[model samples]
Target: MILIVASLCVQILCAIHVIRSSRNQIWLLFIMLFSLLGCFAYLMLEVLPQHWNNRHVRTARAQVVGKVDPERAVRDAQRNLDLAETAANYIALGDAQAIRHRYADAESAYRKALAMGPGGDWGTQVKMAGVLFERGESAEALRLLDAAPELGMGSERDRRALLRARILADLGRAAEARLLFEDVIERIAGEEARCHYVAFLLQQGDRYRARSILEEVERRAKRMDLTQRAAQADMYRWAGEQLAELRKV
Candidate 1:
């Protein structure tokens, strides 16, 4: 009888060890094989600790949510700005200054940043491009933007590509710009993207194609909210009015 009891105790200890080690499947298998001993081990280790930690983490997160403040956000932004200024040697101080909307300061910073390197860093390039655009140097901005790739850099890359297409159209390279806009629409695959593409078509006086694209965009926008629906309707109405004006011309 003592030998049987010793065997049962050994099985229970093994089960407990498996549960504590995070081997749930092994614990389950042993419980099924050893019955009551396995069940008691699981109750002691797996179930209790899992519930305890989960509750603790949730409580900690809830407390953290209450500690956020505007002062903290301001400090974080200032820290980021300082870091960006210190680390970005390849770009001009003028460019950095421009990013913060200090146009005169940005112009000086960009010149300095440009002097740091011949090959462009994405941030510096974008800053320079924006300055050129603001100064009405659209051609130079287009050239710089065209040379840059449009991936891996987040929304900045998408915005640059879209802006480049718009500038190309403005510069009378409508065919090339239209093709580029179409590519962007294909890549992004959403109602907003399609609406922009349709607007571009309408701007180019291709009313028929614009109408078709607008119809598709409208269909997709149905799955969105009333605000989105109203915006799309406005786009269509504007496109129609523009098309009519073009016809009169």
Candidate 2:
């Protein structure tokens, strides 16, 4: 009831803004028809541009759009590839498809990028390896990781390590997986590394340690704003589910 009322309130507010500010009337129709998503569009695209130019807001708006209309990205990427059959375009399409969980399509796209010689770069190799991992080709994924040159630091390094750790875990190399997870958790700041570690710990039957780490996740979450919390909502929900299951035994 409360959420519905808030939704209606926001829609009304955006409609008024569209009229008063002499913005496009199409936005008014959107607010009336699509509800909260419409309001979000107005606020992020129209209102924010006119009032603020914060970096965080821009990122948040992109993430929101991706969440609300994931397929639009895939379509855009596909269209780009259609217009110019370039290696970069294939990569863009592959990434878009991968985010939508279309692993096979992503693999195909990445493979094409690889066969293009110059486009068959190391970065594309890493991305193709990841999609292969998602497709359950764990051994091939590991091979690709093994073949890549050293990535010393940054998000790409962390991502590679994380993917390697998950692959190792799936391959029954628990010791190797644990070491990689421990190494990456110390380097990364986000909830994802910790959450992945917790899952690995639970799989190893170290429920005590898993619970402890999850409690840390909860503690960190308490310091975040609603948007930050929403970004990791699935992780928190999974942590809750794990905690509940742990209690059963």
Candidate 3:
């Protein structure tokens, strides 16, 4: 009896999702006529694919993979690169390598990408800038970002600003860096930009502002799901630590 109730519940939920999401009317018939099999089909064919393609869902999956098997990403990226030396594959390898802090390997991969078919390309350039920045080649990173003065408009453009701000901070260009960081933080809804600003504020000895920003981040985090929180665990940990210390002062 319990199993039957649960099965009906699933079919009803699937039907609700089908209606709410405006999925094909055929799916409703399938769910109503085929029972559990129909619900499974709708989920696998319709729902799961949609969620899997979402960037947040993809990031969540990547975070889980990184936590469970960090080395697998690098290996998988290399396997893909081995299959095709295309720019996208190389960039994927660079990203995997960068995550492992293998800056030399990442840089080599990015260089190969730059030499290949025009990437999702400027994005590749920005990724290379990140690798260069991580490797302490701040000057080169700045040059790459500067070369592409017009990034049109997107996350990458915002990323460019955030990255440039970090590079400037590293170069002792505090005022310029602060302006860039503030611009990106205020305009973008990304926690990373805000976290970077938090770190920057700490370095500048403005603990008060850092605490305020982190408090805001913490408040915003209340609404996030487990995977989203897990994906940002490091930043959240650091933010918490900073907040605790600031409270002491």
lDDT score for candidate 3 against the true structure: 0.88
Better model by lDDT: candidate 2 vs candidate 3: 3
Regions more than 4 Å wrong, model 2: 1-56, 247-249
Clashing pairs in 1: 91-113, 92-109, 92-113, 93-109, 94-106, 94-109, 94-110, 95-110, 98-106
| TM-score between candidate 3 and the true structure | 0.76
Candidate 1 residues 76-153, lDDT tens each?
434665777543532434533454465655655565656666555666776677677667777988887767766675
Provide backbone clash counts, one per model.
9, 0, 0
Candidate 3 Cα misplacement greater than 4 A, ranges: 1-57, 118-120
Best by lDDT: 3
Better of 1 and 3 by TM-score: 3
Off by over 4 Å in 1: 1-119, 149-160, 189-192, 225-249
In model 1, the number of clashes is 9
- lDDT string for model 3 (19-42, tens) is 999989999999999999999999
Model 2 over residues 62-167: C-alpha lDDT tens digits? 6788888879999999899899998899999999999899999999999888887664398989988999999999999999988999977798898899999999
lDDT of 2: 0.87
Query: lDDT of each model, Cα atoms only?
Result: 0.62, 0.87, 0.88
